[model samples]
Target: MKHITILVPDGQTSLSSVACIVGSYEMFTRANGYWSQTEAGKKNGTKELYKIELAGVSKKAEFDNGLLTVTTHVHISNISKTNLIIIPSLVRDYETAVKGNKLLIEWIEQQYKAGAEIASMCTGTFMLASAGLLDGKNCSTHWSAADTFRTLFPNVNLLADQLITDEHGIYTNGGAYSFLNLLLYLVEKYYDRQTAIFCSKIFQIEMDRQSQSAFTIFTGQKSHGDEMVKEAQAYIENNLQEKISVEQLSSIFSVGRRNFDRRFIKATGNTPVEYSQRVKIESAKKAFETSRKTINEVMYEVGYNDVKAFREVFRKITGMSPLEYRNRYNKEAVV
Candidate 1:
């Protein structure tokens, strides 16, 4: 139900609209970069440059950043009715402090005070954090700028390990392409799963509903040393109903217990026992939502040897007991 506004700097990337439609979207351009014009140098090549028009929106141009600025005034005047503000990645001179643009920061702060959700994609997070919007909130940026972002905003809880971090109303995504994932989450949250799925299929992208950490490490290419670890993970997923132990995994991999433990930990950042527990917990969560089974039945389905132990592990990992999680997340999944 929220109306979204996307703030475009000079060199605005193309993916901003993807997030805009997830709610309602308006585009705001700043006084730098190209503004829908073709360059003369590319006229001779087979490629051609074209101008893009904004729908249902008007354009204003100005000058700032020591260059010829052409864009609308970034003030409370333009954003008074917006419910969310999105900052897409911008092309800037990284060596200099283009992030310190005063008017832009003021507009962002005004929007925040007006109770609009603040979001950023890729390097756009730099602009938000530089405006002090991300202080004390968990956020992420493109991995390439992880170190630099930390250096600039040490007060911000920079989550370099995950592709996205959503704490309260603030959302930040890492990597350039993770913008799609963030947008999908917004669609699912504000609209519905079916709408999110429709948009995903339209874009020919995988429907990624899990948190950013789920896909961060399992990208297209798997690490060679981690192959066996992945195999172990697959084995656990396939056999969530069966009890698995480190001793069994060691034999299956044809390695000693200590060697298997070390390899699994090195590859997954979790020990074999810990990883297996996570897999079982996740499986149990799914079963809890979809089946009419009771807590004991769900426990057995996920290979928990005892109901008490299952309750403890499930609570530890999910911050809720099985029944509680089901009540919160299960809603129409079960018939």
Candidate 2:
């Protein structure tokens, strides 16, 4: 079993705990969202004020240079059995500690020297760069911080194009949502294709390989103002396996069919029908890669009742027949 320890500074992005780690994951949060066990606790109301757990790990809370410090002594008084150390995100002032925090810097150096995989998500790359672990190593961070990171760590090979970069056991990802891609990438690497696909489906995300650049997220135009349109889009994503028509979406949103069509097109740059087809096609691609289902079976699974229409849509969107794409990915998987 692989163990992962996530180090969170005073201010860090709060993500779903389930999304962060798979098994036996430990988090060190400084100041963040309140934790709850049941979904009702998170939804309606609860009395939890976000308590921190100090058991199973030694907790060290101190003030250093005007910053609240919370460090966890992981695997202390033992064999130091940590396979992976993750730095999620850090405070904005973390960059100022590049020269300071010699103890933290040395700890990072020692971890890397002892062969623990070091990884960061978002601006956490600053910590790695500050510790000089990324010197001459290829890494990536949130595209927003590329300029500052480049200026600060000139010696580090920075790649802003990709979602994640893995070099010499050091992995870094673009900020926020890019963590999904990073986790999927890691899942594909350490596990099998089926496991990666399963995890992606569970998360309601399309499975994407790391070679695909992270810039895709920025390129998509957002349409969040209209509540009806947003609800329709969410419905489409959740029901990718079911047949969806513009009329059905309009009815669900309690709008006229003509008005819904116009609004959907205006908001998403694609008509409701077109967008739903794209979603189904993307789902089909995942099914093809992850399961032993035949191309026809995948077609039906993605809501294409007619085989001919499914093939045409798949080719139109993917630039290849379903079988062709499947064969290509299969060959690559074998290699």
Candidate 3:
């Protein structure tokens, strides 16, 4: 049986951390039980395929202002070898998390070097990246953390739109409940497709969810201390109904086009044009969510006249066409 060690890190963690730790342990345990009942499992003469345990740096970890606590089954030092390591989500500031959980991070690195696959849930990618395991690997995390993750770990490829990322035996998933999909993925890999499907049915989790883009709210990056770029971002947001151009913005700001583009990208992590489209799309999304606006109406309101062009850009940014996005979000929309 493969041994799975779910790490309960010391220090502050989110409620999702609690869910991930408990949910992963239960899922794997149930998966083992379900597999045992199968005809194939009978032929193997085994009752379980995995030995699951919760390990932590401390005996207990608290959450939600100490209202809840998880008592780990074992300590990290006690486990010399593990087949897989599961790191749960942590509170937002990863630098603080890394500093506080130095021992756990070191242990994670050691385990990986010793041939264990690692899976980080949600913001747990922060810890994994802090350990340098994701330095050159592709990973996914909460979309809201994309800018911060990019700034901190530039070497790591952050696929913010993806629901799950699996490379070099290191797995990660996007925010919140999306971790369920990752569990399904690992079930299919470690067990079989049939078993994974069975679990998905029981858990009521949608299978093969590939993108989290539709759920992302694009808030422009404004922390980069560039006054000119900040003004440009403000202008784009305020004037979403107008067709604005990068050259126009540059001329208005009195900066050369090339230099303006560079500053905009450096400050906002997007070129002027990309930022403009994102801003407009974000406005269109709000209109779709709260208003009973037609797709064409919303498109025109966002400064796009051509229906085809508007649909393409909306789908590119949100992974859903304008009508589909409206129907998904607006309860009044006719599906």
Query: CA RMSD for every model?
Result: 15.0, 17.4, 1.4
**Model 1 poorest 10 in a row by lDDT:** 27-36
lDDT of 3 by residue, 275-319 (tens): 999999999999999998898898888899999999999999999
Q: TM-score of every model?
A: 0.47, 0.47, 0.96
Poorest lDDT segment (10 consecutive residues) of candidate 3:
326-335
Candidate number with the higher TM-score (2 or 3): 3
Better of 1 and 2 by lDDT: 2
Q: What lDDT does each candidate get? A: 0.60, 0.62, 0.90
lDDT, candidate 1, 1-335, per-residue tens: 23555564533323332343222231111100111122432342423122112111224322243244334334334445566666666443432434434455577778788787777877778778878888888888765566567656769987755666777688887766677777766655544565566556655557764334322322211243567777877887789888888999889988899988987765655677877887788777777767677888888878887988998887766656778877766676433
- Clash tally, candidates in order: 7, 0, 0
Best by TM-score: 3
Ranking by TM-score: 3, 1, 2
Candidate 1 Cα lDDT to native = 0.60
Off by over 4 Å in 2: 10-79, 97-102, 209-335
